[model samples]
Target: MHVVATAGHVDHGKSTLVRALTGMEPDRWDEEHRRGLTIDLGFAWTELPSAGTLAFVDVPGHHRFVPNMLAGVGPVPAVLFVVAADEGWMPQSAEHLDAAHALGVWHGLLAITRSDLADPAPAAAEALAEINETTLGDVAAIPVSAPTGSGLDDLVTALDDLAGRLPQPDVDAPVRLWVDRSFTIRGSGTVVTGTLPAGRLRVGDELEIPSLGRTAGVRALQCLGRPVTEAGAVARVAVNLRGVPADALHRGDAVLTPQRFRTSDVLDARLDRTGDDPLPQHLMLHIGSAAVTARVRPLGSDTVRLTLSGALPLRVGDRGLLREPGRHRVLGGTTVLDVAPPALTRRGAAAERARILSTLDGEPDEHSELRRRGIVRKDELKRMGVPVTSRPVAAGWVVDEKLWAELRSRLPDVVARWRQANPLETGPPVDVVRQQLDLPERSLVHALVSPPLAIRAGRVVRDDTAQVDHLPAPVAKAVDELRARLAAEPLVAPDATQLAELGLGRRELAAADRAGVLVRIGDGVVLLPESIDEAVRTLRTLSGPFTVSDARQAWGTTRRVAIPLLQYLDRHEITERLPDDRRQLR
Candidate 1:
């Protein structure tokens, strides 16, 4: 199915052309028929020869109804731009074209209506020339008289070609159906209609109404008035909802795939046109049938910050239009850059933010996004439409490459400073390091640990350097003598009795281990830092599969010291423990 929006001047025969083509009335309201002016959006559909179904979202063309026109055209991808042959180019014609052009609607066919009243050749030529200059590119203009049926067949053929050429929609994409009309049905519950640009909608599908923090089930689905179990993209759909009331669902409300979108009030966008005059303090932003009042701040020559009155479920690269609410004039189009923008609080922040926005081309690349947000949740990047192909630095969290490097570098200094300032203590607690680095969460600090940095007894340590260098004079003297003794006797670990005699209690021993002064095998057996490596070297000379007693003899240590040391090596994967109580190098 294909959907197209009608854009042209009022009384330009847009509705007349639609009526003739579809054999259905395009105007729904009694006021529209009585006044002969389209006051709101009207819908009509017809089955074409080769095109399955072609739906027309008929829009009002008067200056007062420009917002209604924009709302109708916002979600549709293709258009049937109309112009009156008798009047040629009109004011509403230009304004409607601007709205469609700003919305990135490039696929279209021009319809020169009211051909019976005057010569159609001039209007067809002129309107085609005007539309070709916009994002609508080039379109075939058909001069048709609805009353006389002149050129009506040719218009249908042109429309069939346009339908065949419409861009394919991604059915696999998450559903975000923007409601254009919502009302209660007598027999059925609430019914909401919108253009399903992409993604599939199925009966019984539970979709989200983000603003209400609620979910609504798809009770029924209809396309072109035919009930169906499911519908795909590029089709106009009316959904019967089960949970939400008709009064609760309004125009501009969206039904979305749950958890697929992030609702944001602040946005950074790329403007299609940055005119000589700056944008106003406030403007109405229209996208997907939504007209929101937004506060604007120019971030750069082409970028602006928009703070919406309420949050909307938005993604990067989504296109919208900004309009002066009172004038109903479209200022320009907008391409969303960042849905989750940082707060601009400091001096010169907006200037710096503009520089960042300029570097982005609106495509959500992983490197560019991760590089911008140093530390972020994996889901946040996904919700913002960023593809995270690379592995995360930590579980459920992604860190920028440069930021990770900075964290690794700064952590050593932070731990060293903490140790130096408090000699009796181990390194700072994990929570302290998290706050000191201003990390988003506590676990991120653990992912930042690298070489020369280690954790001993659940506290951070500088493994390569013995930071016990800052120990008290008396303790330092005692530890130096013990180090010399262990240096000579590589694996004869100090017993608890000997440690107590040297005034080294559990706290002092724990501090020494965190400082890399010695390796504390459990059960009060302490060895020099390099004793494990020395034992591994000696064991390598023995048989491939060696006994516990063999390991004890190789290290020249007692059974107690050797058992715990071997277990530590096994835990670190330095050695493998055999089923037969034997050991071998891993």
Candidate 2:
């Protein structure tokens, strides 16, 4: 996508050149028409051969209006640096260049205007040399006259050359529009315009008006005096927003994809003073035409922690330069650090500074950044125009592969330590282990927790009492004695009292029950498989169906013992309840 911004001093003939190229008046403001100055950002577009029609952002180069210049240059990737042949290398010209350079603009062409009034050679050479010294230094130069149309062909050719080499903006990336101007067009409702960073906008496309905290529909689209159905990246688009009022929209308000980006409270940045001015501990920050006050605390030497008053959704690797309070010039551009930070105090200032510096020291790569930042939703990366594959890695943080291996290796050690520390207890809870390790993602806890230390029944347990081990010596001997007693009297099983006599503690018996070691078939009775089978045989020989009292008498047991046994059988569906209190089963 090719978007060219017009730069140079005010009245250096930027608007005139735009008019000559597009054959349309970009200075549509009534005041601009009367005062004869480009007060705000003016946009127009025209088709160049093979490169297609390109949009041009005419920025105000007036020294006092650098904010307007930022509004224009914030979204465009390329620029048209204008310098009049009669008045070359003016102050505003340098300011505009600085803004563009801080914004990282490339693929620009030099347009030296008003050739008819002076010998264009000297002024053009000097102006071209000055531009070359800055970020736009390497761009092609063309000297032109808006009236006589001198050098118009050369100017067009230079733009075409730059357009051919400009990087293609990914239309599939997240949609973001930095609103440079907004107004009410007749019968069009509220119209807002700016460069669409990526993706397309159709007539009915719904845009989230972020400043208003609401969504507005695209009612219409117009570009360069022609109506288009859809506008793609790098195109200057006038959108008649439905449902949003004129007052709700303003310059610096962003139109973006819904829920794609999130707001941030703390920002780790790299900043420098614009001039020889002493760096203060606090300053103002300007990014994408938006300005806010931020407390600046330097980290070590290079990085700074910007604690903002309110949250602004920013991606992990978004690059933004700092601008101090009341200053029109740039501080420096820095990739973002932690978007979320705990509120810090003066006492912890040194620690916070160290953390910011450490985060900035890592190479700006996506994998490292996301890992360092913890987790990134697909939408956040999309909103910042950062490709998932090329995402920036936050420096000075461990990668997932190494982190996972370390976590796995540490689990066994953690379990052994827990066992030693809680000698009387079974084990620690899963959450306790997770907290101790300080896992990055909550999902990582699930990934790291495994067998031996953790076991799942109805719920996860960490205690040693829940473990599966051979019975204790006394409990094992008790079980063997009970089995022998039951084998001799196959029709009867030992009661809990008798089992207690065999030396198993109450807790130990309960643990055995939980482990399915001892079966409890009836109340106040303990039974093994042999005892249950012998009782069932005796009942079958006695009768096909029998009353509870008759069974108790035939088994030579009291009603208390016989009734519970009968109920236990009934509960297990071994014997079905019948009419008149009789019981029977095949």
Per candidate, the number of residue pairs that clash is 0, 22
Write model 1 residue lDDT over 264-364, tens digit each, in one string.
99999999873567679999999888889999999999999999998889989899999986765789999999999999999999999999999998888
Best by lDDT: 1
Stretches > 4 Å off in candidate 1? 463-473, 476-586
Worst 10 residues of 1 by lDDT: 465-474
lDDT of the structure predicted as candidate 1: 0.87
What is the C-alpha lDDT profile of model 2 across 1-586, one tens digit per residue? 4688898858728999999998877786898878888888787778898788878888887766777777778777888888888888887776777776666666688888998998878877887777776666676678899999999988998888888888877787567777777889767789877888677888888878666778888888986556888888867788888877657777877787777766665877655334555566666555665656777777656667888765565665555556653655566655575555445568977676576556563234556555654545444544543446632223222335555577778876775677466432334456666677785444455556666445443222344442333345566567667767766764465666777787755665654444444546655465565455666777887757899887787777666567777887888787888887898975
- Estimate the overall C-alpha local distance difference test score of candidate 2: 0.69
